[model samples]
Target: MTTITLGRYLWERVYQIGVRTIFGVPGDFNLQPLDYIYHVDNLRWVGNQNELNAAYAADGYARIKGVPGVLVTTHGVGELSALNGVAGALSE
Candidate 1:
């Protein structure tokens, strides 16, 4: 029997969809999931200066890669900070 954490399962799905890199800013709420990134082969984590920057980076990556890019952010304040970038991606 093999057991995989939710973080690993989600990351596997992201990888299956051709996402080679993930962008985000580390935070107290997200530290646990970030740990799973270290164990996934061929998956790279790019830590940005802030949530907004991470969102922008992910959007740019998706544009260049032709596959959806993934971004991880903490709840509340983190999410709020990334909204402008997310909105930009959506409007584009």
Candidate 2:
């Protein structure tokens, strides 16, 4: 077993789960995780115009790739803006 920070573990899981790209609007709460994810090879972080659009982009990518596309939005409003797409993906 390898010991690593929670952020690293989370990002690593995303990589292992076959996420080659991520989409989101960066913000304070999620910045750390995003920074960590940046160091991962073959993982491209695609910043979107807004959380809602970010969610849509991620959902679309996931649909085509068959992998859970990553979306890193901040807490509160940013996260809320992304909820609809997330819920939609969950339903499907």
* Cα lDDT tens digits for candidate 2, 10-89: 77788898988989998877888888876777888899989889999999999999998788888877778799878887
* RMSD, candidate 1, Å: 1.0
Q: Lowest-scoring 10 consecutive residues by lDDT in candidate 1?
A: 69-78
For candidate 2, the per-residue lDDT at 87 reads: 86
**What local lDDT score does residue 41 receive in model 1, on the 0 to 100 scale?**
95
lDDT, residue 74, candidate 2: 83
What is the TM-score of each predicted model, taking all chains together? Answer: 0.94, 0.85
Which runs in model 2 stand beyond 4 Å of their true positions? Answer: 90-92
Report the error of model 2 at residue 24, Å: 1.0
lDDT of 2 at 7: 78
Each candidate's clash count: 0, 0
